[model samples]
Target: MVKYGAFVLFYLSIVWIVSSCSSSTVEPDAARLGYTYFPLEEKSFAIYEVEETIYSLTSTPVTRNYQIKEVIAEQFRDLSNEEAFKVMRYSRQNTTADWELDSVWVAKRTANRAIRTENNRSFVKLIFPVEESQKWNGNVLNELGADEYEFSQVAKPFTIANQPYTSTATVMQVNDSSACNMKRVYEVYAQDIGLIYKEKILVDYRQTNNICEGLGDIQAGVQLYQKLLNYGKE
Candidate 1:
């Protein structure tokens, strides 16, 4: 009877160990929890309407409207020995025009942060378990100037192109640096999707004091923006 009891206890111990191991192996649902705002999966794609405005101190502002289609083409390893996805961007003059390949970028996500490379410059795009008011030096690893990046809002409701997102975050450039030349960028991301909107503005105040007189104090600059129109994921 003693030996039988000991065997029963041993079997129960094995079962408990297995149960614990299985539970530990389960992965956390970052998407469902709204922890990861940018989901970078292959074949995932988004379409946006792009507008670029150039303001000149001596002349009138010029605005150009276009369409952009961004897609995750494939996966590859970046120079840092980290896994990354290749993103392709196609642009056209309008919705009725044909798209032309514009540029290619790379994006990588780790446990703590998301990194993206564009125009030969790499920067941290997002931080995991996103929290509002979180600040970081986005250009720290890039050896660029101390450009501050901040999460202005987290898990907020946002709407674009008639599509509403329950969980959205806005990341903004908050540093005042001469290197920026009064340039600023803002990016918005939606849960389970990727970038929903982006805006870049450059203000050149040295051109003329009366520049942009009706608009603001700036002399000359450019404003580039993109808004998500649709998205699909495989």
Candidate 2:
């Protein structure tokens, strides 16, 4: 009876260990899979912005021959709140640069809010983190008087860099110029497979004239499917 009891105890111990390992080994939630944050000193930043006006001169007839939607895609890397503020301040200051001036100079000041995964190689959430572009363009900057008004818009969701992300944005203001509020959400494990899995956008205005309309989320799920096939193969 003593030997039998000891054997049973050992069997139970083995089962317990296996159960513990299995539970521990299970993948974490998509939100936690590779969440990454940065301390003040560690955060770094890079800037990229696009303007539609430049394409106005394009012989390709931007709205017809080329994909004009991609132009609004702006990206920023890890940056401190202070750094991001400066970037925005400068962006507002150099609206001409962001619109028609050389991209090289304005690109240097590109900064926006973003959340990256722990690996740094992937992004979990990358958003502009601005409440309203109009407030900045109007009251703060005083670039325009009472005669000017503004609004913004947003996109739905999408993926990038082999991960899934959701984009939410909409028209923020419609003052001297038309603008939109945009954001991107990313996670290590997302439902779709694509570089640009999904997108949601709202363009309040195109330039100085017409309101932005008929703009849809550019789907790239198919391309991501193909890329995944070649991923890590080489």
Candidate 3:
């Protein structure tokens, strides 16, 4: 009887351990996947103000300010019979200037992923079941090298231009810590608004040591910033 009781106690302990481990891995809610942040709805359009700075080794650095309008111009089925969107990009120097056709891109959303094809290159922008701190390869669909993408600030509040967003998700794409070269890229998407802000910086230190002394001096690189100025349907 003593040995049987001991065996039963060990069995119950093992069962408890297994149950604890299973419960710890909480299954993310499907409704909270953050797919609304991508907003593939037809007639969606977003305007963004762009500021770009270019650095050159032998020439003086230059900066340009402009605005871009991205509109969902068309929707069609891709080769795989998946729904795809054609995004038409238009650019203007200022509010009073005419919009010039800039570029064309494509985007699609699957049951498991949100993908955008820019310049004939496909990128897995977001994965379903958007759990905080979840990591995935942003370049999974493209030929580019593997890029680790992590989600943070999930469903967090963010404000821009005195406007408030209830929930936003930030994708941290690239953040290099090397001193000789620096590359930081990230994008912020607002729920029901698509992409709201972006920043990309890749610069090389100009000092004799070829290492970063500060952000002010750069040998050759580019810095780009895009912030949503307006958004609406159609």
lDDT string for model 2 (146-210, tens) is 32222133234433455434532332222122232222311121222112222222222232334
What order do you get sorting by TM-score, best first? 3, 1, 2
Q: Candidate 2: where are CA atoms >4 Å away? A: 1-8, 11-27, 30-54, 58-234
Q: Between the candidate structures 1 and 2, which one is better when assessed by lDDT?
A: 1
Per-candidate clashes come to 0, 30, 0
Q: lDDT score of model 3?
A: 0.88
Off by over 4 Å in 3: 1-31, 209-212
RMSD to native for every prediction? Answer: 4.3, 14.8, 11.2
Model 2 residue 233 distance off true place after TM-score fit, in angstroms:
9.3
Q: Give the 10-residue window scoring lowest on summed lDDT in candidate 2.
A: 225-234
TM-score: which is higher, 2 or 3?
Answer: 3
User: On residues 1-234, what C-alpha lDDT tens digit does candidate 3 reach at each position?
Assistant: 999999999999999999998886675344577778787877789999999999998899999999999999779998889999999999999999999999999998887888999999998888887768989999988888999999999999988888888888999999994767789999998888889999999898767644467666688999999999999997
Task: Give each model a TM-score.
Answer: 0.81, 0.24, 0.84
Task: Give me candidate 2's TM-score against the actual structure.
Answer: 0.24
lDDT of 3 at 231: 94
lDDT of 1: 0.82
RMSD of 3: 11.2
